[model samples]
Target: MPQRLFIDVHIVQTVPPANVNRDDQGNPKEAIYGGVRRSRVSSQAWKRATREHFDTTVPEHNRATRTRRLTSELAKRIVHDTKLEREKADRLAGALLTRLNLSQGKKASDTAYLLFYGNAQLDTVAALIAGQAHDLAALDDEKLAEAVKDLPVADAFSTGHPVGVALFGRMVADIPKLNVDASVQVAHALSTHETQLEFDYFTAVDDKTEKEETGAGMIGTIAFNSATLYRYATVGFAQLTDNLGGDTEAALDALDRFVDSFARSAPTGYQNAFAHRTRPSLIAVVVRDDQPVNLVTAFEEPVPSEAGIQATSVRRLAHEYAEASRAWGDSPLHAAATHTFTTDEPRSKETAEALTAAFGDRISFDELRSGLRERLSAVLEAQG
Candidate 1:
């Protein structure tokens, strides 16, 4: 059997008063953990943020699009590649999707649900349609379905998934064969201590109002909270490699991007109001050959804010990691950490030392990225 390898990432970040993720009532999301309510940010919010970050760093060819407008998107490509008009191209695209058992929404331009598809996959499908554009466009819906039933339209989506799709996976409820199992799992981020929501009540004045105007144009209240969060995510190297068709190089690239993206990405909810774009104070990466482990249990007792939560949280996490290592009986293949404290206090220094003692090395963010890539590449090559 191929060796099992997983990369676990843990983060300690502090955000100012901000509603980065909110519930239906427009309040900051929260969850009760360890007998206390902790501020929460859903995994879906973070995943969307991470995927958005990928657009800036990862190559366009390696990215995927998640949208319900798959038909309209595919139709545009068909029209561009063939002489068919936009209307005919749209009908052809819809027919192709219908043959694949992907139903259209109430609007013909939209799919039944959001479909995650690779850029190259859509291009390939468009190329295939362009080959027989006139013939396919001339047939009625029924005849078109019969003519393209076995032309391998669905195969394009079953393989060659872009990096985003491979990491996050795809679910085609209508067709299980098109599903891709995710290689990464992200836990919802939670504050390390108890939190209470706060509200910001303000008024927006109309810019064009006269100087004598006493009233404001709009008034509202926004609910938010500030917390030092403990975030965790893990990526299965073997699964990622398999997802990329056994291409270790591509898997390594994806891993590198994942680390950078997860560490930097922040959900944009109410960002303009709170400007909560703080980078993590601590980031620890562990490469394990056995199984992935999350060290969040460290904060079960809730770190107190009196001694500075960010520094205290870092120390707690390191101690928990050490305890887990001892209990597991087998050390991880590799471990490293990078931290940035806003102040050079004694607690900050102690936290840094603790991390070095537990993780075995303290490096810069750049070093962490390069080191992980090197370690993953060596393991994957050896397994091959």
Candidate 2:
């Protein structure tokens, strides 16, 4: 059996009064954990934010598009690449999509569900259609299916996944062969301490109100809360390498981007009203040969924030990690951390010392990235 490898990331961040993620009722999401209500940011919200970050950081060719209008998008590509009439392109695209066993939506140009596809995969499909345009355009629906029965239409999406798709994965219920299991797992961020919901009540005055009019134009309330969050995520290095077609360099690059994006990306929910953008105060990455571990249990007994949440949270996390390492005897192959805390204050000094003692010496973010990549490269080579 091949060796298994995983990379685990732990973060401690503090967000001010903001609804970074909200439920249907338009309130900050929460969860009852450790027998108390804790501020929560769902994994879906963070994944969306991370994918958005990839739009700016990851290369265009290495990205995927998620939408229900796969037929329309592919039709446009067909028209562009083959210069076929819009009507002909639409028909051809729709027929090709049908071959994938994907159900159509109410409209012929839409798929029943959102399809996450890589740009390169779409290009391949478009090129395949262009090559067979003359024959495919002349055939009726029945004949077209027969002609493309053996064609590699489904194979286009079965591999060559973009980094985003590879990490997040895709599922096509109608065609089980199209499903790609996600290589990464993200945890819903939870506050390290108990939380209480708070609201802000305000009134907006009409700018053009008459001089005699004293009433406000609008009045309403918005729900929010502030907390020091503990965010966790893990990446299966073996699965990632396979998703990238066993390209170790690309796998390393993807891991590096995942780390950066997962750390820096913040959901834009109610961001304009709250401007709750803040960087993680501490980030720890551990590479292990065994299964991935989520240290969230460390906060099962909520940390008290009377002194300060961020510092206290950091200390508690360090202690939990130390105990886990000692109890499990599963010391990581490589461990490192990058923190923004300074040693000037006593609490901050204690937090820094604890982190250093738990996870080797503090290193710069760049150093952390390079070190992980180097270690991963060696592991991949050895496994090969």
Candidate 3:
């Protein structure tokens, strides 16, 4: 609540019979909440899917690369930008990375952990090396340490975290100071109804031997479940802007991309077999002048309906949200949208309309994202 601004995204998406997220035993993940087992998909899986979507769809400079080959990746950039030989570039990158204390050994490729770094960060390092490449290449251990003694190795290398890193975060155990605090918090999506795990016993048939062969090429049982899931995430507006080094445009772009990708992206687990690519039946966006309020408890009792689980879940979510808003006082701004629901679903329709009206807008996804960006931009301008 100390932070004066936050964005909360609440969703109701119903996936058909599919294994979007799986446990170690290959069953659909589940959690016991409100004293009943419910189908669950981890926040990690969904975040990864959304990040992957951004990497492909968003601009290259706006995304970060997560990899263990940090040295090699940097060395390639140095070689390309500074025109240094691969071996020299590799050595320079190694020396600079050693300043972070992340190397296991003297080998240029040795790194303590995978790095999630932005392209701009790599360019800064390359520029530094280019400026002092000759001197750094010639210096011995003692003199080399003295020559680069004043470099702001930690903070300097940490600027310009890509949109993904700025929103999600990066941590290096050996260099904790360089870690970027995550501005967004994602909750593990859980079903709004009781979940029962099911298995699909499938057999692969070889094309060469078809009709006459009674034997199967491969046979196995894959576990899965179907559920109407409730997904929630909260973004700290202040932290998000700060994380981008006060670049409001990039911050706004990140917010827009995050909402779009998070809404459309689904985990790829067993997708070839299940093909459960589903859009949310309902989405609620709330911008508050206080801390985030998650509505996962809306389904604490689990909704049952002979007609449709999504319909029941939608009604429950709207009612619970309305009650929560009333209890907590009016939110600064709110919006809701849906991809599916019919006129016949009276309770669902009424609840959705009431909730939308209470939220102050019933806009499409694009409009919702643009409005959020405009609001945040105005806030930034006002603060400035």
Candidate 4:
């Protein structure tokens, strides 16, 4: 059989009184599930939080920066590293980026779109201008433009990719060849139970105020909702490997960092007022050789409120998973691991370890990480 690779992650988390993701009107994002409203946190919000975790937790990992100030940033580097004056450096940097179709505005002071690039890529562009600054400066306007056109912009990314760029990928509007499709797909998190929106009327009193003042400083209403959220994301091992240029070790490392960060990170929205910094109550990691399966349909009817929502949701997940395996057979499932904090729910017949038992060896978080890598490496090698 051909080697197939994919990782599906499922998480059940509960957040207390907080607004993790808000919409345009300053209310928490929501969606209709099972004919009832449910609180929601956008995929972008959580992905950003996960990226921030990767930035702080992963050491020696080359990271990418997403910004609109590409020309300005490169100009500073040119001035600091080379003997060119600020004015000359700015012009040269703008010219090089303009040729690449990355700059806009009269002076090309900023990028037309947000550019996600690695430190190495930016450094290469700066070094190019520094090397030929004098020769390029002496040319007429037409000659300088023609000279830059001959530069090799495509070969700039010859070196290894930064971890962030490799994972999230990037798109160059005018240069489709430079576009990198994302290897990971994230689904917007939705609440398992029906939502009940609430508002908090807040006021801030000025520290230095007149003694006879009747009214306080600022007052406003903030919208929020609390519920158990079902979060899902999938990582394509084949695409990840290709993105890393077939480097197996780097792919494994990327997988490790991704899973860890996704499990621990939560968006920092309205955290100052409501510090809802909680971890997942239940987590399931599935490694499949076939296609990815999302058990979200189990909640399509929405779990009943009679039984505790979290406990009932946990039971429904296990029941649906068992049904899925029985219908599809174990050929698709390579391995599985699960972790749960809510163990003693009398309502739930399937505990974390019990649900994951038949799928694969029940193991700790660290063991699961290492074991998956080892198993995947063996599978990939045998296929070769």
- For candidate 2, the TM-score is 0.95
The alpha-carbon deviation from the true structure for residue 368 of candidate 2, after best TM-score superposition, in angstroms, is 1.1
Candidate 3 per-residue lDDT, tens place, 1-384, comes to 124678889899989999988888889999999889999999999999988988888667556888878788878978887787888778777777667777573544856567888877877776776776766867776777776666665665578788888999888777788888898899999999888988999998887885767888999999988989999998887788788887778777888888888888899999999899988888778787767888888899987735578877777777787788788776565454644554457755665565565454456777778887787767767666
lDDT per model, in order?
0.89, 0.89, 0.80, 0.78
Poorly placed runs, candidate 4 (over 4 Å): 58-61, 103-107, 134-140, 157-159, 342-350, 357-362
The residue-level lDDT of candidate 3 at 245 comes to 88
Task: Give the local distance difference test score of model 3.
Answer: 0.80
Off by over 4 Å in 1: 341-347
Q: Clashes in model 2: which pairs? A: none
Task: Report how far off residue 345 is in candidate 1 (Å).
Answer: 5.2
Q: What is the TM-score of each candidate against the true structure?
A: 0.96, 0.95, 0.89, 0.90
lDDT of 4 by residue, 1-384 (tens): 225688888888888889989999989999998898999999999998998888886553267778888878788878877877888877777777777765474445876788877767777777776777877877777888888886765556534676777778888777876787787888999888888899999898999888998687999988988888889898888888777887878988998889889989999999998999998766677788777778788789876655478866765676777787888775654556655533365444355445655445456777767777787778877888
| lDDT at position 137, candidate 3 | 68
- Evaluation by TM-score, superior candidate among 1 and 4: 1
* Cα-based lDDT at residue 167, candidate 4: 79
**Is 3 or 4 the stronger prediction by TM-score?**
4
Cα lDDT tens digits for candidate 1, 1-384:
237999999999999999999999999999999999999999999999999998787667667999999989889899889978999998988877776778678886788899998988998888877778998898988898888777788998888889998899999899999899899999999999999989999999898998888898999999999999999999998788888998888888898999999999999999999999999989999999988898889999998868588889988999999988888796888899888742366657787778878876678999999999888777766877
| Better candidate number, 2 or 4, judged by lDDT | 2
Worst 10 residues of 2 by lDDT: 340-349
Each candidate: RMSD: 1.8, 1.7, 3.0, 2.7
Full candidate order by lDDT, most accurate first: 2, 1, 3, 4
